[model samples]
Target: MPLGTVLVTGGASGLGAAVVDAVAREGGRPVILDRFPTGSGHDEVCVDLVDARAAEEAVREVSQRVGGLDAVVTCAGTDSCGQFGDVGGEDWDRVVKVNLLGTAAVVRAALPDLEARHGRVVTVASTLGLRVLSDATAYCASKFGVIGFSRALAVETQGRIGVTTLVPGGMHTAFFDGRDEQYKPGPDAKLNQPQDVARAVIFALQQPPGCEVRELVITPSVEGSWP
Candidate 1:
């Protein structure tokens, strides 16, 4: 059977957009939670995921409107690369708020609905989540936090809801568009296509009842981030 309504954070672009398209191709309805509308014809809720309360309310509202949500994909993320002290305090905090707390808020809000439908959640972490690097303090911390959160959540929600932690390496997206030259990957750098990475999410979501994909790591063959 086709998957039911799927809620995707950051569904406006990059990896999330790919997931949205994949869900649609598989005969599922996709709804978006983004700071701006994607114009891809999916119903989109424009709200910053940083506000935990607002994020949760948005999820509830969207879920109600969509009839019910069968899955949630948290692919929204932000990064500010620089020395720990070089980045502004608020700027650094925003990364943590958006990447870590934002992920938690949406999942927490969607839990009741997911439990009702025995739904799945795909939380997007990063290769950085498993390793340390220079000039990416905020991004690293937030993704690492996401990894920890997804693991505990899986344990807590086992036998009820499916939780999958996605450890994705670099992708060819605007995620690096505004980065400083120093932070940008080299021209020859290899990165996975967003669509390819998103397919992993679909695989997790399509698992038969009582089966779950607890963790998945996907990257390019020549990727630098994944060891």
Candidate 2:
């Protein structure tokens, strides 16, 4: 079977954009669900993922327009760095909403279409989800939630839908652009490229029926966060 129609949240940039490009190159139709417009003329549905209902609606919209989905990659994520008590409430809350809740919303919305096609889901998690760091309460909490959620989801939907949780370390993307100097990766930080991690996503999506890549951890050799 072909790659078919796949929905990628946050497909406007970073790892998500890389997956979109890879999916298209492999002959699959990549539908984007993002807050920003791609301007590339690809099939897209622009919506803020923090709004679970709106995210769900966007998935339905894409599924209907594309004639059903074969896969969905929840790559949308955000982080607010600072001491737990230092970060503003809204910023902290937004991290959880966008990372943990948004992932669930998109996947839940895609479940029906995925079940119909025996489709795949690849949810992006972080190394922070496994190891804790100071001043990273919001990001850690949200990513940890993602870890738990994806694991349980895999068991619950076993034999029906393919679920893979991608745990990646720091990457060379704009994900750290607005961070404080202390929070930003150091000048010599060995970060993997977003495209590299994205290839792993394609690998999971391409798994043959009756086979599943349940979880993947892709990080740079000297990744500081993973250890």
Candidate 3:
């Protein structure tokens, strides 16, 4: 089947923006949902995914504006790093709310439209979800929750809708703006480009109805190890 309309959360920048561009390049109508303007020609829904009511309203408004919904890509996520015992309660809560609960809220809002169209859902998780990282307890926990949630959702949907979890290693994006300098990936490290992960999302969306690419883990070949 030809690619149709796609809705991308966090589409203002990073992997989400790349996914929006990829979808547009492939002749799909792409709609962006984010807190800021991307300045792209595609429709935009400005909302904070962590705000449940706003997220739901934005999804409904986008679905109506687009006439129908065909695909959803949940790319809105954030990470925080701290030793389990050192991280404050508020910090942990904020990370989990944005990375885990926020994603679930977006999916809950979009599931009806996805089921109605038998559309695909591509969620951008992290390689950390599959492996543990020291000092990143909250981030790892949130991503692991995402992976589990996607698996359960896939089972519940049971072929009525396609669900995919995109687990990618260190990307060349500004996800670590305020992190301690030592924690950042080495400059020599060949981090995956945002576009690389976006391409994976496109690939998942292009699958046939009878097929589902349940999970994909992508790491840079130069990394030489699983992230």
Q: What is the lDDT of residue 142 in candidate 2?
A: 95
Backbone clash total for model 1 is: 0
lDDT of 2: 0.92
> Which regions in candidate 1 have their CA more than 4 angstroms from the true location?
none
How many steric overlaps are in each model, in order?
0, 0, 0
TM-score of each: 0.98, 0.98, 0.95
lDDT of 1 at 189: 94
Ranked candidates (lDDT, high to low): 1, 2, 3
Question: Rank by TM-score, descending?
Answer: 1, 2, 3
Per-model RMSD to reference = 0.8, 0.9, 1.4
Write the residue-wise lDDT of candidate 3 on 61-102 in tens digits: 888888878998988887767788988988888788878888
Query: Model 2, 87-124: lDDT tens per residue?
Result: 99999999999999999999999999899888999999
lDDT of 3: 0.86
Return whichever of 1 and 2 wins on lDDT: 1
Kindly report which residue stretches of model 2 are placed more than 4 angstroms away from their true locations once superposed. none
